[model samples]
Target: MENPIINVKNVSFRYERENVLENIDLSIPKGSFLGLVGPNGSGKSTLLKLILGLLKPQKGRIELFGMPISKFREWDRIGFVSQKANSFNTGFPATVYEVVASGLTKKIGLFHFMDKKMKEDVISAIHSVGMDPFIHRNIGELSGGQQQRVFIARAIVSKPEILILDEPTVGVDVKNVQAFYEMLDKLNKQLGITLILVTHDIGTVTNKVTHVACLNKFLHFHGDKEEYEKLEEKDLSSFYQFDVKVLSHEHN
Candidate 1:
């Protein structure tokens, strides 16, 4: 078996006196599409933050690409799309090309003009997300789904090995959500980018992801989709700390 791209061992965290996560262990291998499902306030987002090095765990360790997060400095190796990215100011004045090109600002440094290769990379990223047609459009003028795709292009502009998303389809219309997921699937399979998605749409994500991790201040379940699908309602309910049902649905 290949080594894990992301590893969390005996991780625990808290906010003041409240314990948010306790003794969490998870391993995500290369090319794995992992879905993180849990109820609200279940510490799903917190765990993502921990893995992203945005927050420090009170106890235990986390590794990204086999390097300890605390010592890891190669941030360009990972891409992140937050839940609030699609909610950018409607009047923000930036073109899609400009937005996607911003992903290289850190590497390019201040006041440095985009060279020919950088411009090609920008266009390539937009094409990867199927937003080439809107490459020149104003980012603020696009629909929520379109804007989300542009942000995804921005995230992948650097060609990161791992992509972490938190509730990426929140503001997107139902009609476009499936397409958004399809694009993500393409990125994972064709591009070979590892995916870690934190979402509440278990019914929808279960069909798309290769692995599932159930979280609620603790690691309740961690396994492949087949085993997750075989779980009983009672087991799921216990994991979520409430009554829940796993519905069967077909993916488009």
Candidate 2:
């Protein structure tokens, strides 16, 4: 991959005496939707933290947008929506527009007013996620899947080049899960945003993401979706070294 957007080279990390990651090397290209799948305690979250610049690797180097992560200060170019967003307080009195608009705090300043252009950006983001009708509704009143869309709108309101989601569909109903992924597909394909989704639903996400990467303190596989689809269930079982049978789902 020439000038990959995210580059992790010979990266290793540890917490106390427990080695969390070992000689991990991964590269993500721009405009590629990567499904990062792994079992619990497989260092999936840790790798995300490293990529987000929240944690530094103990060994090796990380570069974002071809710049060393340590020197990379374009934080706004990367947006992240955490799994905790699904657990937001239901009683919080914030409207969908208000919640999404908050994402511009860094750009607009905490106390600054949103100019006409900034407000349009917020509305555009909401519309992009198909949440225009619910723009004025209370976030807590929306369904789990709807709330996730609002959160995604907030993340993309900044017009980030890369959007990273950690277990985004945790609280969504099974019926709405597929629609949520379809929306993500639109974001990756139409909007041309690079996406790195950390998820446990290997079976479901593989259907949407362009690439697949399996991690278990080590990278067992990293390739296009077609290549990943070619792997046998037994191979995935060995990669996880735990329990993560990739069950096939019936999608419409």
Candidate 3:
């Protein structure tokens, strides 16, 4: 009920030769979890990139916390975990502590050294994500699940109020995916951090996230879980053009 933390008004985006997203509008409240779902090439990642200010919108405006994203100065308040984190080489020669500490680079200001408080914050973040034992271990030595957690620690080290992730579960094992989602849910429910996740796991995410934003080259639907639940299989089949239903755990 608070003013929307993120607002997209008639926004549009396109690549070099094609229009990928059309006049899209969205509003996300603070302390909420929103899942963006759609088939491949649906502009889900593009939208997230726009929010992160990686790409400029072709038309319209995007506001964070009621101000134009361009004017917003609280970059540290938001955290981002991209799919690229999974591919980061473990042989990169960095410790988990160092990786997490990098998140405080911004807050430490330009050219400043890491202080005691920053180190403590990084350690706390690592512990929060259950990666304390591996804090001193080499990043490359960790498993895929452990690596993902380190990235999560990096994001949380900044103590961000909102966290956004793109395809976080991609390339991870089934058990690790569950662990990752559990961490996300904990951050949302216990820490009250608003979360926006762009993923293809509709069945799993739909049940966990507080809200849903379905996209397909445009904003198809953005509403609560109850609304998504009311949707019939036939309605979803039309969008997917095939049998569609939340995948059961048994199927996974």
Clashing pairs in 1: none
lDDT for each residue of candidate 3 in 1-252, tens digit (9 for 90 to 100): 568999998999989889999999999999999988889898998999899888889899999988999898888889999885568776789999989988888778768898788888888899888898998999888888788888888998888988998888776788677777888888899888999998888778766789998898878788998898788878776666667777744234
Better of 1 and 3 by lDDT: 1
Q: What is residue 32's positional error in candidate 3, in angstroms? A: 0.3
Model 2 lDDT per residue over 1-252, tens place: 899999999999999999999999999999999999888999999999999899999999999999999999999999898885467888989999999999999998988899999999999999999999999999989987888899999999999999999999988898888888889999999999999999988888678899999899999899999999899888998998854567766465
**What tens-digit string does per-residue lDDT give for candidate 1 at 86-117?**
56898999999999999999889978998999
Task: List candidate 2 segments past 4 Å from native.
Answer: none
Residue 63, model 3, lDDT: 92
Query: Which residue pairs overlap in candidate 2's backbone?
Result: none
Q: Candidate 1: list runs displaced more than 4 Å.
A: 248-252
Full candidate order by lDDT, most accurate first: 2, 1, 3
Which 10-residue window of candidate 1 scores lowest in summed lDDT?
Answer: 243-252
Candidate 3 at 210: error in angstroms? 0.3
lDDT of each: 0.90, 0.92, 0.85
Worst 10 residues of 2 by lDDT: 243-252
Task: Write down the RMSD of all candidates, one decimal each.
Answer: 1.3, 1.1, 2.1
